[model samples]
Target: MRQHFFRCLKVKITKFIAAGMVVTCLFGSVSLGFAAPQPSPITILPIDRAKFVSGQLFDFLIEVKDADPDRIQVTVNGVTADKYFGKGAATDREASLATYRINNVAFKKPGKVEIAVKATGTAGLSTRTVKYDVVNPVAPKRAKNVILFVGDGMSLQARQMARILSQGITEGKYNDLLAMEKLSNTAIITTSGYDSLVTDSANSASAYATGHKAVVNAMGTYANSTADPFDDPNVENIVELVKRSRGMATGLVSTANITDATPAAMVAHTRKRAEQNFIAETMLDPRHRPDVILGGGSRHFLPLSTPGSKRTDNKNIIDEFKKLGYRFSGTKSELLATPPNTDKLLGLYQLDNMNVYLDREMLKNPKVLGGFDDQPTLMDMTQTAIDTLSKNPKGFFLMVEGASIDKQLHAMDWQRATYDTIELDKSIAIAKEFARKNKDTLIVVVADHAHGASITGTYHELDGKKGREAVRIYANAGWPTFADNDKDGFPDSPSPDITLAVQYANHPDYKEDYKFKAEPTVPAIMANNKAIANPQTSGEFYPGNIPSSDPSEVHSADDIILNADGPGADYFNGVMDNTEVFFGIVRALGLDGNRNVK
Candidate 1:
């Protein structure tokens, strides 16, 4: 009887074990069907599916998070990348990120190409595939010369402001249009870089110079995963290309420093715009050097021994340029006296940025001029640049920039910004006159980016309604009483009885008095790294909208206007990207991307 009972118990235990096995199999299969967590997303510079000109150099980069460098595999067009490009890949490890780069690579053929990357580590595997389109079309009839005018942050509103002040309005009609308005071709230009929607002057100008979209604060080069500003992978700019392929003369002019972003984009390549001292030295490079360089920021050119010098080294760039057969000019008188036959010219007018038109040309205030008062006007500089560069029998490329338009707008000084716009218009007129005589020159006037200010009717204190209460909108806003009485195309005074109520779309914490400041004053000041309203002013206080990191107004992502005339101007008519400007210029000049280097 005991043996029979034990046998039954064993049978029960075996059945229970069988049931447990079945349950385990069912649940294990379900768990196995679940997917593992995905790895972090990869960052690819120039982005995926970016387009490029055939034989145009660019860096190909892949960044993987928490990945091992040895486990990373990069392939181009389904083959090993290093083998296909004939160059080995470079790896950089920063913290938990692994970055692989192939520098100075170009697609010689005109077609679609693919780049694939796979990275594996303790966090698992991450894969990314990017495609690029390369094109090399034969250009049409080309222009002998090209002149590009960049009114930094000059928006449609800024143009209108200039028109109202310079052209004068009568019975809802204007007496004349600005020279830029008289252009035959116009287009809305979108200014965004690879990194963000809003772009700074550096990358926006880079798009025009290199025909590639770069990140903010970078120009003529790709922003890489490195701390060194000068070591980024470089792309040849118009200055280098034209010099290399056709030996064309190149010139750059700006109201700001020569090493500033807009002008520097024409020749210099670096990840940071603040490296002005390095840029001052980089201008000495012969490969992409400009024949005519004129602007401000003389401090960067002076040696550390000089009292006002901003350079940390003892090298004096001015003396260095003088040794290179360049006729150096330190003041407007010197620049005007520079012989027209001079092949190379370098002009530095101020220790920092040159004063705006209202102060330098009209007011001539000694305090405002800061002893560097002999700065040349934009028109004067434009004429001088054209006169000097036109001596090139092989033709020339000149970039004239009205940089202070953006600078004044950042300070929320609409009146000063308007005057600078007028200054830019006058310079454009000079270019137009040059173009009329030499029809072979393609002239393009564009803005690097747009400002936030707009005309919201008019404001007046005649009714004793001061400040915000004085603002008039729609029908109540009659024509502004700005009069160019001397026919000089500039309002005698910025603060007239009645004026345009220019409103800002975005701003930091600031005071708004609905009146102009006599001196160029900042709207906000820095306090503990936060943008705070200027305590010195009394007006309606506005809470800040932008981050505290910025102490002034910022750029907008709004589409800017581009006006063009002369040869190849027809290429610009519809909505276009900023990169298209470079292509247009290249097409107009018939630049060959694949020209064999000697």
Candidate 2:
């Protein structure tokens, strides 16, 4: 009876072990059966599953929630990260959040690299793996100089509108192509950043300045957990790289404020682009500052004691730059009068953004100019920048921006935007002329983003059918009657009898007047935190399809065109990410970021 009872007990024990194995096979692991829910997955910067250029510097960061630093293990390609990088990461703890940072790390060779992190604590065990492709590029014959022209929001439609209005069309065929259209090489550039489908100027320009994608409103820096804009992890921009590695002269010229996104991305390292005052001060840093800085935003350069100052502090940046031997110009006349031999220049034509071509030069509207009427044209600024930057025996990198194209388009003023596009083309002509002479200057013309505007048909008031009713489409849509009788690149008058019916693909609740305002005007105004049609115009009211939070038309995710000429221009062919612009420029300049300079 005792032997039989022992035999039954052994069989029961064996069955129990078999049942446990079945449960382990059904579930993930034996430990997981008794363990609590896994901890939240780790977050890493430079992200996982992305491609990086070999020798490009970026910050390595990791965040694990509710995990002890001692319990975390990070490895790169099965080896400890500290051993792979030859340096350990710095750790910081705040309550349940633990942060690990390894700054300015780069992959020297080309290959696939995997970063794995495992964290174990009371919560549970969590793991994450990030993969990166480090690319090795071949050296090319370098160009002596590179000129990048950003026609802010200059879309294909914008280009066509400029071509029609400036060059005129007769019998559906005609005169000539714009300078940008005549470039030797072209590419379709995708402008989306890592954070979103559509990108702002700051992040878009950041891609070209630094060969890394950034979040919107951020430039040359990765957005961090801190509230301080300047405290983010920085990726060295083209200005810094060129200056530090090659001792190249740099110039930034724009119709917008010098502290604005496009130009500021070339130097400033901040997560927030709207930090105008801080950006103004950062422009004085000798490490990355440009040799020629021309545009507006004098308000930020003035001290708090000054009448039109925008800065909160008593620091007078204009005075500081003057002390550093910068020749400052405050007007068109002053800019022209600046000596040709002046090595350094700081020109601020207005307290805010310099007026657009239509308002400042063509119309000369006092209301829009606001006592600052003598702003120089974008062409003037570009020519001046080129002249000053060329004085250096070493080659220079100049970024010229036609900023008001985006600004006017946001206001739903297509005519003004088209004029600015023409202005950009003229500036491109200037750069092409310079490139022709130098033979070694690489000139790239591209847009940061695209507006939601397109040319649908033609509008005519001859029949007296007003607004939307007068919009003639298809076979009925005749050619526009824009004329350039004076031989100037601009149309004689913006408001012709038969003009192009430009429409916005996306807009706020606004009136569609289908006519150009004599002065600059906003399409929608804020009321009760919502966008409402401006009562200033009379037309058919259309409700917005976009969110009410937006006061104007927003940028589109559509790809923009990039045109290039001169040496190394062949690299710009087929589709490319905006970050590739930086690589192209680097290849043209043969920049060695690891090189040391005095």
Candidate 3:
């Protein structure tokens, strides 16, 4: 009886073990049949595509949404910014937020900057990453001095128009040539930044100033999370590097405000270009301060108590410069009469942009700043900058920008844009003349970007029709008849018997009145956060091709022409990237002082 009972117990135990195995297999199959719920949306924009300069400062940020803060993790090339930048990150756990920012982090050697951010939540898991290439230091060839001339929005067609108007073409032949036409070296540079195909003046100029490309409206820095424009990672600019490393003098001259995008890029770094007030203040930084600064927009340097000042404080930058031994001149005569031997010069001719060349020198239009009657031309500013900078025995770097070409184009004023192009050419002429005497100077004439303006043939009032109907094209597209009999280097009248019919590839719907406006017209204005054609115009309407959000014709992703002369200029041959311009300038100056402090 005992053996029979033991046998029954063993059978019961075996049966229990078989039942447990069956239950386990069933649960495994059920789990295999179902999938996890999808995670919330997440986006990652790569910042690592650029070839970053070693030891340069940049931002490291990761964007993630719908994930719990406690579950998010960030790593830079497998390391954290806490370890890279030596700063601990703070997270908002209560708000379900996660953010990691590393400012002024330096890449010690040439390689790659790979960033990985991983997040997991109740929904699921996701990851995003970016990689950046770092390059070894390249030693530049020796050059005594460098002059960069920026023709704001001056494209090849603009150059052609200026040549036709200023030089007068006779039956396909030209009478003389533009001053920039005789450069010893030439190259076609493709201009674009990391963020977009088309770049604004600030970002494009930043690429030239710092051997690195930044986003639109940014100068010498990249966009990162933060409301403070001053907090962006700073890249050492030519103004700072040249002065600090080689003791070289630096100067910036422009027809627009000295704090304008093109000129400010040399010393300022901010994600937003509209921060002109802050940029003006940054100009006072001892690192990148210019030896000679000449331009318009004196309002920014004056105290807020001053009626026309643009500053929000009583900083009085003019007084600060004067206290620092700079000769402050506010007029053409004052700039000219100031002793050339003065080591520092600061000239501000107007509270706003200087008068256009046509108005300042020829037409004498009284509408814009007529009170400042003696404002100097771009040529005058260029000559003065050269004279002041040349006083430095250690050599100098001067950047002269004719900043109105883009401004007039934005206003849809082709004639004004043409005149500004002429002004830039004249500035180049001054530099070329100086180069003739001083072979040690490297002179470069180029545009930061291009406009979409093109010659749509000729438009003659004698065509017997009106507006677009009279626009001459194809076989009827005869050459324009712009004459310069006085040899003053400008057409006596922009509207000749035959004027070139230029059309904007991108613009708001507006009247096609083929006549140049005596006063500038605002093409579009903001209405309900959208740019609409100005309702206050008297001409027929034409629809816009670009989005209504744009108030004016937009910039094109077109290649720009770079003309160069003097030593180390040969590097600008063939088609090159925009960043290469900065390299060319640095290489010309042999700036390998390694201004980085560990």
Cα RMSD (Å) per model?
Answer: 9.7, 8.0, 11.5
What does the lDDT read for residue 394 in candidate 2? 76
lDDT of 3: 0.79
* Count of backbone collisions within predicted model 3: 3
lDDT of each: 0.88, 0.87, 0.79
Residue by residue across 343-398, what tens digits does model 1's lDDT show? 89999999989999989987888998999878899898899999999998889999
List candidate 2 segments past 4 Å from native: 1-40, 49-54, 77-79, 135-139
Write model 3 residue lDDT over 523-564, tens digit each, in one string.
888899888778876656888998888888878878889999
TM for every model, in the order presented, reads 0.90, 0.91, 0.83
lDDT string for model 2 (1-598, tens) is 5565566556554665544432232222222143343445587777655556566677787878887877778898999888888888888867777878888887777789999999875669988888988765433667878999999999888999999998888788957889899999999999998889999999999999988889999998877766889867778788887898788899999988889999999998899999999999998898888999999889999999999889999999999999999999999999999897899999999988888888888998888899998888888988999999988877999999999899999999999999999999998999899999998899999999998899999998899898898999998898888878888899989999999999988899999978889988898889999999998877999999889998899999889999999888888999999998988888888776666579
Cand. 2 TM to true fold: 0.91
